[model samples]
Target: MHEMLGNQYFLIRNYFEAEKEFEVGLLSDPDNFKIKKKLIVCYIQTGHVDSALTLFHNIVSTDPKIITDTNPEEDNCPCPEIIYELESILNNSEVELKTLSLAMLWLYCDLEESIWYFEQYYQFNKSTHIIKSILASLNKEINK
Candidate 1:
């Protein structure tokens, strides 16, 4: 099964291979939360922040508490590196990346910051149902 092979790749830090396998695995079992979670990890490990956020929004829309790999000790976590990278380019006219970086920053740096970013994003894109759902989930998470 793709998930089995993907697990091996994930364990070895072959995130690209793991990502491919997980993507395939999802095609057959779209609701397999485990695969989607791992795929989110793979997306981040591969520097596909947009992809990771898209998938993350999908999962978090239903359960906001599932923000994955916020721990610095987690294997190959690039969140800190990403945050660091953002400092140099945070104001480089890449609106999406800046907002996405904020989303990521809260995972590894400050949870409240993510809420602020999500709130700002919502103000500009109120029609985005996914952002609304994510914002609600973030509120739910903070309230708990």
Candidate 2:
């Protein structure tokens, strides 16, 4: 039911509503990859990059093989389309390097690459409190 409504909202480009429904669905079934994927998209559309990145990390961390495998029975595995969209976002010029690091982490890129991006962003934008806060959060999360 929530999935269907979320799909409908997504089709209409009403990403906020879709996000809400998907989040609600996830509350009941935290392991539902399909809903998580949809919620990721919603986060992207609504500029909730941090949330999207965190969820993406959680999803991949839960099943690293999902990044490459495509077994039909594995409904939790992300589809190629979602991967492509995420990659596209990572490549977009408007996306900050910190955000790119999160996406890179999601794609299972070298941890060093993510750290490098974050460090570069921090070095260049030290005045940005959000970046500082994000760096602190990332550091804590990565170290854990």
Candidate 3:
């Protein structure tokens, strides 16, 4: 119930309110991966990148323990299905989702996909120099 409301608020662009709901959901079910992921997204949407990054790092770090034969660090990025879901959200009016997706791609040095998402984000929200600079750097790297 709380999770659903929180996610609804997030989709409606009410990040602060969504954060509260997600925080409550987290308190109730600390190990719910879906809730955790949505909380991370809410953090990112609200410009709480440190929190989001911490969560991302933790998820990646812990995956190896759950899947014995898998080397989480070697993967170098979140699962492709996660990426596709995020990218699909980005294709919607979720500009913050696009930003986070691009940031993840950039963090992974996924130059090609980063450039694609960044271009789409830039087209929608042209106010940020940070994203533009990232796009420029990625473009330069791709060209090189």
Best candidate (score: lDDT): 1
- Residue 38 local lDDT, model 3: 56
Residue-level lDDT tens digits of model 3 in 40-120: 656765768667756654543454122222232453223344556666676577576556555543434354655676677
Give lDDT tens digits, candidate 1, residues 1-144. 999899889777788999999999999999987787668767866778778888888877767545543455554444556667666676678676577646755554566887887787677667988777777887887788
Order of quality (TM-score): 1, 2, 3
Q: In candidate 1, residue 25 scores what lDDT? A: 94
Question: What 10-residue stretch in candidate 3 is worst by lDDT?
Answer: 64-73
Candidate 3 Cα outliers beyond 4 Å, as residue runs: 64-101, 105-144
Clashes of each: 0, 0, 0
Please list all clashing residue pairs in model 2, or write none if there are none: none
lDDT of each: 0.73, 0.60, 0.60
Q: Candidate 2 residues 1-144, lDDT tens each?
A: 888898788666688999989988888888888677667767866778778767766655565334323342343323234445655676557656435444434333344444566666566667866555545554555566
The true-versus-predicted C-alpha distance at residue 25 of model 1, in Å, is 2.6
Among the numbered candidates, top TM-score falls to 1
Candidate with the larger TM-score of 2 and 3: 2
